[model samples]
Structure formats: structure tokens, C-alpha cells
Target: MSTDGKSPLPPMDWPDFQPGWVWLTGAGPGDPGLLTLHGLNALRQADVIVYDALVDERLLGWARTGALIEYAGKRGGKPSPKQRDISLRLVELARSGKRVLRLKGGDPFVFGRGGEEALSLVEAGVPFRIIPGVTAGVGGLAYAGIPVTHRDVNQSVTFLTGHDQNGLAPDRIDWDAIGRGSPVIVMYMAMKHLDQIAAKLIASGRNAAEPVAIVCNASLPDQQVLETTLSRAAADVAASGLTPPALVVVGGVVPLRQALDWRDGLADASVLDAIGRRTRDAG
Candidate 1:
């Protein structure tokens, strides 16, 4: 129980909520404004926040003064705290009755490993809540002025991880099925193996000239988007030195991006304007 009179007040003959423990939270993709109310509440109340590398640090400023922050980011082939260790630490902090917040980039359940951590907490009999966030596959695409689902393009969309933590294409994912099945495919963390991935999709009967859009550092000032055909995607990324923490979208929806893009006139503003005028004239 906390020393404060307002906190840790017990219910008559019932168990109390643990104060020192964790909330495994997703901060959303790059945009601080996208944080859920529950997530923001946890951040403000937490005694410590263990966060991923991709999480924008600026969001940490929202935490109450004197809160502790820990970095537990795991990047492919980069030195990082082991997942097991991170999970165990959450348990440890909770046992101590300290409010712990495990902050991750994007939805923690979407390839962010919130499940593993949640299971660990469950095993320890710790109560927890899931605060979902706007995942990169959707939000990142939106930031780049691309819509994952479009009435004219696709009614269905598929979200997939590019590679696993080991830097290999996830063995469990059926690339062939995904290539053949999904009308619109959005991938996260696939830049490193983009060449081989592109080849696989093509071999699975996807068109070589199918449009592919790669948006790196989505929703941030350093963001860049590259438009290419499936066959040229890997080569173009390589040539341009684009790196991961990027989102890739494939299929016809990539074409609409050229028209939907509204910022800095990257898309033809004149064209959309002309189309609007024509619609008005027709009406």
C-alpha cells in the first residue's frame, strides 16, 4: 500500500490493485498525438517507464516529474536487453509495488511482443490492461498520404512483418499465400531483406510492375517516400540507402498515393484541383 492517504485505500475484505507493476502500452507510430487516453494516463501515473527505441522520446516529457525512464529497445542485429530479462524486470517492478509502464512503438500486440510480456505478468498473477495504439502499417501509411483501404483500389488489406528479430523473413509467415491473397499489403521492418522479399512475391505470381511505396521514418520530419514497381523496389532502396523503421505498401493502392498526397505538393495538386473543377462543372 502506498504511504499517501488518497492512494492504496483498501476495499473491505477484498484484494487491492497492485501499484508497483506494469502497463504494457503502445505509443503509436511516431506521432505523440496519437497516444490513447489510457496510455497517456499510465504515462502520467507511472513511477518508471521502460520504452522501445522507436518510441518518440518527446512523449516521455508527458510523464510526471521525477519518474524513472529505462530504454529497452530491440533492433535487428543490435545490442539490446533480452526479451526474457525485460519480462522478468516487469514482474520485479510490479512485485515492488511501483507503477511500471512498458512503452513500445506502435501497437504493442502488433509485432511489438506485448503478448509475451502480458503472459509473463499473467503467470505472476499481476493484473494488467491493454491500451491499443495506431500501428505503423495503418498510421505510417496515412502519414505518407497513402490509404491502406480505398473504395477504388482495395476493400481488403493485409498487414505483415518484413522480418523477425533474427533478421530472417519470419518462417511462420506464408509469403506465397500473402502475395497471392492480399489485395493490399503493408509491411513493417522489411527493408533489410527487401530484395529477397520482392523476388519471393514476384515468384508467387505478383506482377513485376506492381506499384510499391516505401515510406521511411513515417510521420516524422525526416520522412521520405519512394514509389517504384515491385521488381525495382529493392534495388531503388539499396541505391538510395533507405533504412528500416519504415513502412512498405504494395499493390494498386500505391498508385492513389500520387493523387492523395496533400503535403508540399509532392503529388500533383494541379491535377486534383483540375479534377475538382471538372466535377463542379459537371454538376
Candidate 2:
């Protein structure tokens, strides 16, 4: 394994993380191994690391000694720092001549509200850099042995959040259009509203028996995957006793988990060969 647990790659001169600049970075799901080199570079250089709840604590180990680590994670129904306050804190820290690193789980741009924070920094005249990380929608699903797309399943996929700014199912989302157009739908933080979302899709013409997979604590050692039908998803998830910080995937691609699950020792050699053949054929 590479020193960081990620795949080995050619070395290059990394960018200088200037003090008094804010770096918004994605920590990549829950696995330290999945973190981008650029994100890792920030960790080693930042004076203060402001991290979210979903970010694995293990990644913080890479930070420089004496680097101040601050918690600013926001969870459903949890009393946490307000978004605006968090943005202001970045501005405050940057102005203090500190190298501020805003480390979040998954891609900072994907449903992470990084853009909002960046805008605040811009208005405050704070220089910043964006380091994209592997989103849970893809990386997390991969860890659960579920592909977002497959030649035999879907050619397109949709990524969406389960709730809006108000912490409820988004009212702006066109369930009808998405249900009818997208063959595969990957949802972040949808476990809380799974029943309603599932109903909306079913009412919008999605099959009631469509395969759905919910992955919790994705990319972590204790990751849990629960598979059920669109109609029974809510019930099954409740029965499984899993909580939030989970991803919900809706599509025909979910059943492929039976063949693609490779984590630990769960991989089946025959299925692996079949997947290889299919991939080669597609290529």
C-alpha cells in the first residue's frame, strides 16, 4: 500500500499553502485513504483545521503537530454551529494570518455548501483554494459494492440531497422529472426522509419494486449496507436500526452489489470474473 493508503502516483511539486488563506477541501467519504494528495498537503500545512462531523478523525492524524483542530460538524436534529457563523469563522481565522483548512466529508462542492462558504470568503476578500475529493455518492457506493452506473443498468445517474436548507425534503426538486428521466438516483442524507422520497418516486412512475440500497458510515470499517425495494425501504431501514450519515441509492444497479461487493473477504471469485468480462466487453 502507498504511504497514505491511496494508489501510488507520480510525484509533483505541491502548491504552497500560504498562511492567511482558507482552503476548502473534501476529506473524501469516511476513508483517509481516499483523500486527495492536495487535501493531505493542506492538512500538513494548515494552522487551524476546521472539520465536519462526517470526516473520519483518522485523517486529522496527518496534520502538522500543534495544528489547532476545531469541530464544526452539522448533523440532522443536532445543535451545531450555524452555516453563516462557520463562514465568518473562516474569515476571522484567515484574517488572523492563520492557514485555515475547512475539511469536509466528500467533495466540498457536492452538497457540502462549500460554495456558500467560498462566496462568503470572497466577499470578505479572503484568498482561498478548492481541493475536490471523492464524493460519497460514488466512493461510498463503491465501498458498498454498488456502482452508480452500469452499461446494462443505466447510462446516466442523478445525485441529490435528501433535504434542503430547512432540513426537510427539498420542495424545489422535481420528483416527476427526475423519476422519469434519471435511471439511477443517488441520494445523500436521505435516510431521514426515505419513506416520503420513495413515495414521491413511486408516484412519479418509478417502479415500486425498484432496488434500493442504503449505505451508512460509508468507506469506514463498520460500514453497513441495507438493500430493499423502493416500497419497503423505509421499513427495512428502520428494522435494520441504522441511522443517518447514510446514502440511499435507487436504481436497477443496486442488485449488482451481490456480485461487486469486494470489501473485506466478501468478494466472490466467479462474480469478479463475470464483472471483469463485462467491463472488458464494455471497453
Candidate 3:
């Protein structure tokens, strides 16, 4: 077994990356190790790879020699291609007899827009395969010692995006219901409107003092976790200068970090505060 990042696999009965077909694969959060075997296989065989903004570029090194690389990533508040254009590009590449690979961060279908691209492939009659990867909501939280669901803390979890295409809080989501019903909530792309979203939840009856943890650059070497209350989440994030590409989780589970955090560094100051509060409460 190779101890290094390269994966020139010892041959197996792997499916062929046929010309005129696209494989939509997930690269996982930010850790290259989180990549699935099937995703790695697709990489070594694809003639061309179209990747997203969040995808770790290091994964590209595993691609076949001379394989073409194309960037199709979209970041909020930046000039980016239209989703339609990206989908069409996949079709164009596949139809041109290239072994196409559409790579994304996290699970392709889990809010990664893999479904929309798949539909485009379908409409174009291009064959494709899906290789699922660990989503940041689950895997990212795990690295930060926050469980999305636990028998002792929560039976239901809600995963949501903080903003819609217009870059504002989503109006269609019944925030009131989610605030009350979901014992654990994981939010993607939420840092931008953290304060507004927190207020909405509080207004919807969620406790202002509920524990909330923001995991930044999750699963990466520079990963940082900030633990605070719903009321303090926005303020703490601002004061700490935490940025996007982060996951926000709200629940009683957030306090469990005291016992669960196993990373090399000490837990954040806010996390220590949470532990003291919990200890006092238990006493």
C-alpha cells in the first residue's frame, strides 16, 4: 500500500471512464483523505476534470498524466459562471468524446448542485456515475467533536443553507418550525448572515443561550472551532474574524466538545467557557 498521496492502484475490476460520459464525484470537505476510492479511480482515468471552487486542488495531482483541468467553481460575492454554463460545459466535454469528470466538494448531491448537473447530463443523453463523499455537516462536525445526532441529546437534525441564490436568508424555509423541531441544526454558507439568522431563530422560540459551534476550514490542517451561544455566535465570529467555508452547528451537542475534542490543540476559549457552565449546571 502506498503511504503517499498518489494512487496508481493495483489493478481491480474498475469501470471504464468511457468517452462521452461524465462521472460526478465528491472530494469530501477539505481533507484529501476523506476522498472515496471510487472518486480516486475516476480521477486516474478521466481525460478532463471540471472542478468546483471548494474542491482541494491537491486531489488533482492524482489525475492521469496530461489530463486537462478546468475550473468551474462558484464563490458567493465573486464573479462566477452561471450554473447553466457549467452544466452545458460538462455536456460539451462529454459529447466531444472526452472522459469527463465533474468533481465537487462534499457529497455531489448534498447541496453541491450535483443533481442539477446530472439532469443536464441526462437531458444531453450523456452517461454518468455518482461517487458520494463525506459531507462537511457530518464529517466536519465529527472532526470538531460535535455530533449531529445523539441518543442523549437529539433525535432529529436539520441541515440547511443560510442563504439563497439572492444571498439573503431563505424565505421558504419554515425557520420557526426548524428552530423548535430540530434538536440539532447544521448550517452551510451561514456565516455571512449569522446575526440575522440567529435573531430569527430566537424570535422563533429557540433559546438565545443555546450552544452553537462554528467549525472553520473544517477537516483541514488549520481548522478552528469556536463555541458560543446562539446570541453570541455572530458577535464571537465577528470578533474572532472567522470566515466562510465554515460549518455552523447549533444544539446541546455543541457542549459535548469538552469531552469529545481530540485534536492536538486546546479547545477554543469559548469552548472552555461552555465546559465550565455545563459543569456548574450539572453540579
lDDT of candidate 3 over 1-283, digit per residue (tens)? 2224564567777777889889999999989989998888888888999999988999998888889999999999999999999999999999899999999999999989999999999998999999999999999898888778867677789999999978898889998999878888899999999999999999988888888999999988889999899999999999999888999998888887876777755455566666656633422
Q: Write candidate 2's Cα lDDT for 1-283 as tens digits.
A: 1344534335777777898999999999998999998898888788999999999999998887789999999988989999999999999999999999999999999999999999999999999999999999999999999989888768999999999899899999999999999989999989889999999999999888788899999999999999888899999999999998899998877877878788955766567556555434322
TM-score of 2: 0.92
User: Which ten-residue region of model 1 has the weakest summed lDDT?
Assistant: 1-10
Error of 1 at 44 (Å): 1.0
Which digits, one per residue and each the tens of the lDDT, describe model 1 over residues 104-220?
999999989999999999998877777788898888888888888867556788888888767787778888998888878898888988888899988988888788899998887
Clashing pairs in 1: 20-94, 20-97, 20-98, 21-94
Candidate lDDT values, in order: 0.82, 0.90, 0.88
**How does model 3 fare in lDDT?**
0.88
**Candidate 2 wrong stretches, greater than 4 Å:** 1-11, 269-283
Whole-model lDDT, candidate 2? 0.90
> By lDDT, highest first, what's the ranking?
2, 3, 1
Prediction-by-prediction clash tally: 4, 0, 1
Best prediction by lDDT: 2
